[model samples]
Target: MSAPATAAQPSTFSRFLAPVLLVAAMWVIQFVDAVLPLSFTGFGLRSWDLQGLLGIVLGPLLHANWAHLIANTGPLLVLGCLVAVEGAVRFWTVTAFAAVIGGLGTWLFNAPGTLTVGASVLVFGYFGYVVLRVFSPARLAHRLLYAAIALIVIVLYGGAMLGGVFDAAAGVSWQAHLFGAIGGGLAALGGRRRAVSA
Candidate 1:
């Protein structure tokens, strides 16, 4: 008797679909924001406001303007795809960690009434995950490969990541960047434990 056919793995393009669709959604939302009479930015994370708590879920999906979204698109796609390469679940898990932790941290730390919005939180989160994954418990070969990838990611984004957290200009929220990175690192370490137990 012939063996049952094996399940086909997803295509490389399919693996990347999540981030692409996320960027597309950002663009579409920006278009709608521009054409409509309403301001979506108001829905973003507001410090010390009870109603603003919803921004933890909505803030990353909104942007200040086309410039803000444009600035975030490249890094989001690059770092997002890096995380997605593991699988869509990992990608979204990292995203949720970054959004919730980063948003809460920003809300708690930013001056009262300060409004924060953008995908930069996730960008920094992905950056953190990629770098910290190097230390995840794994086979030596896998750890080495992760080390190489982490090195490359650091070379590419280290300066910007540092600036995002430590040298942000007026009106920028460094708290979000710092806490987003913390969230990603936590996800990486948490995943390490899971992998060991599995």
Candidate 2:
């Protein structure tokens, strides 16, 4: 009898494939923007465009340019790993919640008539989730995680925030950051409550 066919090796596409494909798509969009200079506004979802709402949802998958995407890549990989560990269901739940809520917050409060684009809001939301999870009282593991996240934030955003107070180009929306952080905190708390009830 012919030897039993070994189960097909899992495709590389099965591992990190989703996120990789997503990042690749983002890169393509950015590249097209560079070559064609397509307006970043209303990429076919006008009424739903809802200003930077697209940024909150599709933002994580889009970038201002290669440099901007590159700057975000490391964090995206790290946070995506963490969420993946949390399992697909919870991972998607946290991400979707953060994006929707963070986007809504930005839409409600961003400078009038100004449309924002990019995944900075979702990125900030991931950062916030990491920060809150590390500090959440749900588990000892979370405490350690929180401490590490705090260190990262201090290392990354501490000086940037101070600079924003003085620099004009630092017109970064502190609001998006604030709401993203809030969404993360809320997600962590909700997760903790569910764990306790269970």
Global lDDT of each model? 0.90, 0.60
Residue 9 error, candidate 1, Å: 2.6
Residue by residue across 72-122, what tens digits does model 1's lDDT show?
A: 999999999999988888899999998888889999998999999998888
Give me the candidate number with maximum lDDT: 1
Stretches of candidate 1 exceeding 4 Å from the true structure:
1-8
**How far off is residue 85 in model 2, in Å?**
2.6
Task: Encode model 2's per-residue lDDT on 80-158: one tens digit a residue.
Answer: 5555455555556666766677667766776664454555555566666666676455467757766876677758765
